[model samples]
Target: MVLHDALSEDHVEELAQLLALIRRGSAVTRSELVQSSGFGRTAIARRLDHLMALGLIAESEPLPSTGGRMPRGVYFRADAGRLLVAELGATSIAAGICDLDCRVLSSREEAWDIAAGPESTLARLEALLSELLRDHQAKVWGIGVGLPGPIEFATGRPVSPPIMPGWDRYPVRERLAKRFSAPVWVDNDVNVLALGELRAGVGRAHSDLIYIKIGTGIGAGIVSGGRLHRGAQGCAGDIGHVAVTDDQAVVCRCGNIGCLEAVAGGAALARRATAWAREGRSGYLQQRLTEGGDLTAATIAAGAAAGDTGCVELLAAAARQIGDSLATFVNFFNPSIVIIGGGVAQAGNAFLASIRQRVYSRSLPLATRDLQIVLSSLGDIGGLIGAAHMVVDEILSPKVLSLWIKEGTPEALAGAHAGN
Candidate 1:
């Protein structure tokens, strides 16, 4: 029998409630736990002791009471172990270490250019992981990688991604597992960003949200009822390939024409900026660009910030186009929130204001009420933490929990405690 199935239904329900309470802020008293979890006192105590014996939870002495009997409490240890998050992007690879609360403890970045393909990227990731693990004494719980394309969750392989060439069948999970000797998970980078936003960033206060990432490429990740929807083929959020225009003029990376990404990706924006600059059509981007310095999302963000009318106009247009694409989503999903992230989102309020105006004005009025259009609060850290959350989810699973028990990693204890 699976370790998860070993627990009774009542035990599972109590455990789920315990995790939710601990995740909110671990310092729950027994009385409060009973109220929040709706479990009998004996049952809660029994489960707590089981988790404690697993080295997953520890109890604290009674607290000072205002006018009543002091109650003993339990709390999750934030630094019991470590979670590693590596974000693999088209232009750079960023890695971060997060504790139980999902706060970034340490992070580092290196540019290797995703165009270099899987081997070079994997090598860079290994180097970064070594450097990060070398300085810390904590045992790692799991490793989560955020890749540039839709992924197969079971195998951790990208499947026929448009922009990411030569990576369609990359064995990311197996390769990472061999290096780390721990469970590893790979997911679409934007999906991880959406997860980050949903749990710790802008989408925290709202469920039924859509997270759109506009960067080197365009994609969306959807969360409904606080759960990610990856679809049957893990391509539920592959909005970049949606045929927005019927022109058939420019070919997309997927061999399709008039796809949204082909028309509005960062490469498209950079090419337009370069042409305008060459023609002396705008001095704004010219002033922002340094000799031999590549045009980047930061440069574009800086251009818009510097009051470059052309850059601002281009951003607004991109926002309108994105908004147009999202209108269809609004009609279908009617989400309560929409979060925009990725390099381009660094444009901040200027970009957010435009997208908000377009989405609200163009979409249906009934759907617009209580709808939130916001930028990612996680900033560049979204991908990393989202990756970590993926590992955490698996670690929280019953079968994985049993494996974690056998491994005796400190993070497994922390997770079990959160469940209790």
Candidate 2:
């Protein structure tokens, strides 16, 4: 009901610091909290009690110590609330219902067209969420969505999304908030993929990494200093439009010529494969194209696996081209890891090897020295998990906590928790 019993600024600051310490496992017991936070014993005890009362942190079983008395481990209460996530792509969508910890309770994928615009796609996603929430009997504290285009992060609206027609500047947050009674977050789908990898996949080890998605189109998600970097206009990693060739013949979805996506992405590779088959360069690819009615990145990979040189060369060239762009990024960002994912990444080791070879050979020695080029560990569901994580991060931040405290923990804020 938005009732007010506002917390003082000092109280809110102390809560935020304590929350971070507990969540990050830097401090658990009163002694540890005192040492890390430098708060007096009474202050630590008081903050801990308040957090427990707010259903934010919980003390689990004590750790087994070598010789001293055991101390209980304080952890964020993941089960306190739930989140709904929709990971949208150019041709499909994956949605999930997850806990505050980003654990997927129930998840599913369905074929969808981003070109179908926001209205129909949003409705379908809500329908899926409704079904899942009903079955699980879960209440939503927040909702997260990853769209296959640039998003105006502050407003949760698409901005000049080439693939998402009729969705430009659409009020995604406003519409979704109205329907679900929760805060909503939106971002480019690849950014979420990077996030999913960071939390649940290979990115668990490395703080700095570049996540490249080479599907129907190509995009990169840059994680710098362990955080997703969405640039000034939320198009920081829009590398698809970056020119790879000067040839005027190659055209991209955004109508630009020689863009990387037009020359080396899955769609581009498939188009090249088809042209080769029609020209009878590879009889195997020709027969497969005839049988399947079209050539795709997957089919081309299969052909390459079956010893088709043309298919192999096609992939190698694409990989080299992609690697050239990646080399530039590696030099520019000097990330510790470079994860390649999506349809083209699944084209087998040869494709990966070619890209790695090109990147290592082309990039500066310093950047390449510590860089580890690898395939995505999350595979298909990374975006969904990332979306959930994004919402969870927002709902639990200091500002959101202040809002909640000011509102006296309304029903919508019941399960929300965060730190400074």
Candidate 3:
């Protein structure tokens, strides 16, 4: 039942602020809430009571005190609802069910092709989510998705994603909202990875950072001032298409010549490896191809590990090209750290060393002085966690919270503030 008539807008705002404090673990007691929110003791008590009545927060054991009265610890009710999240890549999908605190309770990963089109991909994803949700009876508060393409943040639709054919302008959020009766948030996969790292991985301590994913394609997620920075069109960090060379012999799937992804992405490296194998320039690659029928970036890395000079040179060349492009970003953005992830980053230390060498050599001195380039610590599950946080952050924002606080459940507000 709606309680909008009982609470004033000012009261709702105050309640949201109080809830935010508790949810972030910033204020764990009545006194802490009063001090953090600058509210009178009575006002803090009233807000806490309201949140507790709504089942959004609860009081735990009392804190130790030196004086007379002990304060009970206020905590967010993380298990009150569940969130469905998925990270969709060029050739794989990772889906999970998370609690309000963005903790994964269950997850599933499968190899699937995004080029199969949005209809088939989303249908398969829906089936996977259904399987994960089958045993749980928790309320699904929201859905978050990370796609391998540019997205229109306001509409949650893809915007001419080159690697994702048949996905341009697809209604991802709308479809998912209709399917599950929950609001959905969609973003580029790399942006999701950046958020995951920011909240759960190496980026937790650093406010300004860049997350670069070198998979079938290469993309970047930029975080400035501790927030994901999606530009005006929500495609700010699309470094994959940045032109790195004037050569026209190499054409990108985006119809561009010598773009960074075409020169150094996992797909590009594999394509080059295949040519090298065909030309007999790499005996190791030829043997691997003859056995496996196709060469991949992993094959090249394996050959390099086996001391194949041609494979090592190939890997180094791709790394140097990627690093050269990254040097421009380092000089311009001056991020505190640059995190490398995705399938290509798994090529081992030699690939990382090559990229680091070029970045340090080509970047400005001041930028390189304090810069730290490292691999992603979260590995494959980063996007799923990021997707969970994305939805939680939105659902818990002031405006959205105000709309749903009266209802006690965001289910009534599904798709109302989606993509906003």
The lDDT for every candidate, in the order shown, is 0.77, 0.85, 0.90
* Pairs of residues at least 3 apart in sequence or in different chains that clash in candidate 2: 396-417, 396-418
- Model 3 shows how many backbone clashes? 0
Alpha-carbon runs more than 4 Å astray in model 3? 1-10, 65-68, 415-420
Task: Score residue 393 of candidate 1 by CA lDDT.
Answer: 77
The candidate 1 region of ten consecutive residues with least summed lDDT is 411-420
> TM-scores across all candidates?
0.90, 0.93, 0.95
lDDT of 1 by residue, 110-197 (tens): 7768768888788888888888887775777778898888898777899986667778888877777666656677888888889988
Per lDDT, what order, best first? 3, 2, 1
Decoy 3 TM-score against native? 0.95
Better of 2 and 3 by lDDT: 3
Highest TM-score model number: 3
Candidate 1 segments whose C-alpha is farther than 4 A from its true place: 1-13, 286-293, 402-420
Candidate 2, residues 208-292, lDDT tens digits: the string is: 9899999999999999898999999889989988998889889898999999999999889888988999999988789987887
